[model samples]
Target: MSNPASATGTAAKAGLTMGALGVVFGDIGTSPLYALRECLQALPADERSASILGALSLVFWALLFEVTFKYLGFVMRADNRGEGGIFALLALSHGEHQRPRKGGSWLIILILFGAALLYGDGVITPAISVLGAAEGLESFNPNLAQYVPLIACVILGGLFLVQYKGTKAIGRIFGPAMVVWFLVLGSLGLWHIVETPAVLAAVNPVHGFRLLAEHPTNAAAILGAVVLVITGAEALYADMGHFGRKYIARAWYFGAFPGLVLNYFGQGAWALSHPGDPTSPFFALVPEGPARLVLTGLSIVAAIIASQAMISGTFSLTRQAIQLGYFPRLQVNYTNPDQSGQIYLPLVNGALALGSIWTVITFKSSNNLAAAYGIAVTGTMVVTTIAFYSVMRRRWRWPLLGAAALAAVFLLFDGALFYSNLHKLVHGGWFPVLVALGMLAIMHTWKKGKEEIFRRIYANEITEDELCNVAASDRIVRVRGTAVFMAGLARGTPLVLLHHVKANKVLHETVVLLSVVTEEVPAVPDAERVEVREIGQGLGVWRVVARYGYMESPDVTALMERVRDTGVPVKLTETTYYFNREMIITGGDTRLWHWQKRLYSLLSRNARPVRDYYRLPPMQIIEVGLPIQL
Candidate 1:
C-alpha cells in the first residue's frame, strides 16, 4: 500500500498467479508427499487398516473445507487494500462494534495474541516441512540414516545459502518445478488408485464420520492426521498481497488440491493391498528398484520446491508483521517488484535455517518428527478459525445462523486435531505451545507498553495555536533548525513537546509533532493521509499521522518530505528529531502486572534501533531521557 517503489512494486491491482504460487502454495504444495504419510505414522498398532483410510479421508476433506471454503471462497474476499493476513482482517473488523463481543475491549488483546502465536508457527513450519521431506533420502537407502544429519545440514545450509541473493533467481524454478511436482504426485497416486479401486470409498464424508465413530477411542488422533492436509491453508489467506485471491484459488483448485487428494488416496490404497510392507506408505506406493530411485529423486525436488515456498512465505509474513508493529523492524531485501515472488529477510532466514537443522538432528527422521509437527500447525489453524468467524460476522455481514453453521462445522474439525495433538503434548508438541506462550508474552507486553506511552503522552492537550502563541511570546528563546517533535496523541499533547519546553528553555519554529498512527485502513488515501495544522506564527504543529499497510515501513523522514508542500514554510536542512528516552522507574505507582512491567522495560530498550530503523540521520538525532513507570 506504500508506493510501489517502497519494496517490490506490484501494483495494488497487479496480476496474482505468480505471486500466489510462490507465496500461498509453498506450505500446501509439499503436503502431497507427507500429509498422509504422517497421519498413518501416528496410527495405533491395531487400527492400521481403518486409521489409514480415515487419515486419507480427513486429509481430503480438510483441504476441501479449510482451504476451499473457509479461506479461499470467503476469507480472501475480505482483504484490506488487496492485502491479506490476520492483521489485515483485524483492521477490517476494527471498530465495527466499538469493542469486540467477548468482554469487548479485550478482543484486540485476543487478536494480537492469536497473531503472536501465528508468528511462532511461521518459524516452525519451514523447519518441519523441509526436515520431513529430506528424510526421504533414508527411505531410498537405509544406510543413509547415519548420513541423515549431514544430508539435512547440507539442505538447510543450501536453503539459507540462496536467501541473500533474493528469491527472483530461484523463483523461476518454483512454479515450474511445483507444476511437475504436482503432476508427479497426481500420476503416482492415480496409478496406485487404479490398482486398488476400493480406496476411492474414502471420498464419502460418511466414511470419515464412520471411521471416527467406529474407533471412538482413536478418533481424536485420526482427525489429527487429516489436519496436516490443511496445515498451510492459512498461508493462502495470509499472503493475499503476494498473490491475489483469485490466483490462489485457481492454483489450489486446479493444481495443488487435486494432486494432494490423489497422492493421499493412493497412499491409502497402497497400504491396503500391500499390508505386509513396513516402510512408509509413500515408499510402498512406488514400484521397486530403479522406479523407486526415480520416485526418490522426484520426491527430493518436490520437497525442495515445498521448502522454497515455505521459506519465501516466512519472509513475507515477517515483513507483514514488522509493518503492522507486531514485530520488531527487520531488514528487507526486495528481488522482484514486477512479480511478488521475490523477497528476503536475513533474520528470519537465519532463524528458520537453524531451527530446521536442529529439528532434523533432534528427530532424526520424519516418523519421529511427525509427532511435533501437528501441534504448532493446528494451533495456528484453530486461531485462523477464530479470526475467520470474526470476518464472517463483520466483513461479510453474514447472519447469525449462517456464521454459526460454518463455525460449527470448522470447529468440529479443529477440535479433533486439537484433542489428538494433546496426546503429543510432551512428545514435541510442547515446543510450539512454549513458542506460542513466548509469543503471547512479547505481543501483550508490547500492547501494554504502547498504551502506557499513549495514555501518558495524550493526557495533556496542546494545539498548534497554543504552541504558536508560546513561540511568539516576547520572553521565549528560539532555537534554529526544524524542531521535529514526536507525539503520542493525534489530537492532543505530545510528550516530546511537553518535555521540550519544560526541561530545555529553548523553542524552535516549524515544530513537527509527528505521531505515527496506525490506521484501521491498510492504506490511507493521500487526501485523508496526514493531518497537518498550521497555528499561524512561526511555530507550526504538523500532526503528521503515518498510516502503514501491514506490508509497509513508516519512515518519518519520507513522510516529512511529503508534508513540506502542505502550507508549512519549512526547509528540511539541519532538522533535528526528538524522542522520549524512558528510564525504568521501579519504585512508583503502577497499573500493570509486575512481570509485564519488567518485560515492557526490556522491550522499550530493545525496540528497533531508533535512528537506523527509522532511516533518520544519526548525527541529527536527539534523545531526552525521561523516567516513567506504569
Candidate 2:
C-alpha cells in the first residue's frame, strides 16, 4: 500500500501527477534549449541527416524503453513509505531488518552506494540546468559570453534565495511557466518544420539506425544526444510519490511528450533547411528583434522553473535519504501541511547554490558546461535499471526472464547514453563523476561508522530479560509520567538504557522502550507501524514509530497522538522523551577509511537539533552523550 499518512486516495492520485509535472519533468522540459543543437554540433555533413534521425530514434527509444518500461512500469511500484527516490526505492527493495541481522551483505552495500550517487545528482542538476539556460545568452549576442557566468550566478542565487518562502508561493508560477515553455517549443519548431517538410525523415527509426551504422563515432555521440532528452528521467520516478504514478504518466503523454517531440523535429527541420550555419537552431527559431527578446525572456523563466523542479527534487530526495539512513540527519521543515509537497531544507539549498554558481563561473557558457551534463543523469538511469530489475523480481514477483528482457532493452539504451556522455568527460563531465565519487565515499563511510557504533554499543548478548531484571532491582522511584527511551534496536538493550542505569541508577515507573522504524514502502499504516505493549512492571516498553510519506517528517509529538490508544498511558506532566547524543573519537576499530569517520562525526554533531525537529517539549526531553571510539 502507498504511504497511509500523507497523500491518500484522490489527493495523492492527483498530487502525484502534478508534482511529477513540476519536479520530474523539469530536466527534460528544458532540454529543448540545446539537445538537438548539441547532436548537430558533433555530426558531419554526410552523416548529419542520418545522425539527426538516429539521434531522434535513440531519444524516442530511451524514453519508451528506459523511462516507460523500466521506471513507469516497474520501479514506481517500489515506493518506500509511499515515497519514491533512488534511495527510498533501494531501501524498499533491500531488506532492512533481515540484512542487518545477516550483517555485511552486498544488498546493503549497494543500497548505500546508490544513495551516495543521489548526492552526485543533487550537485549536477542545478549546474546543467542553469548552465544550459544561461548559454541561451549567446543567442542574443555572442559577445554575452563574458557575462553568461554572471547571469548564471544571479539566477542560481535567486533560486536558492526563495527556498525559505516554500514552493507553494513559487510553485504556482512553475506550472504556468512550463506551459509557456511548451507553447514556445511547439510554435517555434512548427514554423521551421513548415519551411522544411523533409525534416520529417528524422521521426523514422530507420534514419536514426542508418546514421549510427554509417558513422560509429558519430553514433557514439547519440548517447550524449539521448542524454539531453532523458536528463530528467529520474525525476519522473523519484517524484512518483509526490504526483502519484498516474499524474506523471498523463503529463508526459500530454504536455511534456508532445512539446519535446515537436520541438526536436522542428530543430531537425531547421537544420536541414540551413545546413551551412553552425549556430544553434533554437535561437534561429525565434523571430528577430523584440519578439526574440520576449521569447528569450520566456525561455529564461522556463529555465528557472526547470531548476526549481530539480532543486525541490533535491530537497525531497535528501529527506528520503536522511529518513532511510543513507545520510546523517539534517533539518527538514514543512511549509505546507495541506500540500505535503512544500518543504525547505537549509543545508541542501545552500550546497546547491554554491555548486551552481561555481559551475556557471567555471564554464562561463552553457556550451562548455553542457560538456559535463549527461553522465550523472545517464548514470543514475543505469543504476535505476539495476534497481528496477530488483523491483521486478522481488517487489513485483515478475518472472526473472521477462524482467531481464524488459530491463535489457532499457539498460542497453541507458548504457548507450552513459557511453555517449563519456566523450564529454574531459570537457566538463569529470565534475559530476568527481561529485558522485566524493558523495559515495561520504555515504559509505558514515554508514560504516554508524553501523560499527551500533555493533559496539549493542552487545545483543545482554537480553531484554536481563535488563528487566536489572531495571526492577534498581531502587528508582516510579514517576507518575512515562519516560520514553528511543532505541536503535528492538530487543537488544539500548546503550542509552544501560548507560542511564549505570550513571543514574534510577528507572521511571513507566519506562517505555520506544523505537521508530521506517519501512521500505513510502507510507506505513498506523495500525501496522505504531505499537505499544506492556513489557511488565512500572517498566512498560512503548514501541512507537511514526511513518513518513516520501513527503512527511519523523515528528515525535505528532506520532504520540497517533498512538495514544496504545497501552502506554500519556500525560504531559508524566511524559519525558530521551534521545542518545553521540560523542565521536578518532581512533577505533572501524572498517571506515579514517577520513570518512572524521567527516561523519563532524556531520552528526551539527545535524538539525533532534528535539526541535520532532517538536518535543524542551523541559520534557533528555539527551545523554554516549561517547564512541571510532
TM-score for each of the candidates? 0.89, 0.90
TM-score attained by model 1: 0.89
For each of the candidates, give the backbone clash count: 0, 20
Q: Cα lDDT for residue 549, model 2?
A: 46
lDDT (Cα, tens digit) per residue for candidate 2, span 507-579: 7766767676665556665467576665645655545544554445666776776656564577656688887
Q: Tell me model 1's lDDT, rounded to 2 decimals.
A: 0.69
lDDT of 2: 0.71
**Worst ten in a row by lDDT for model 2:** 94-103
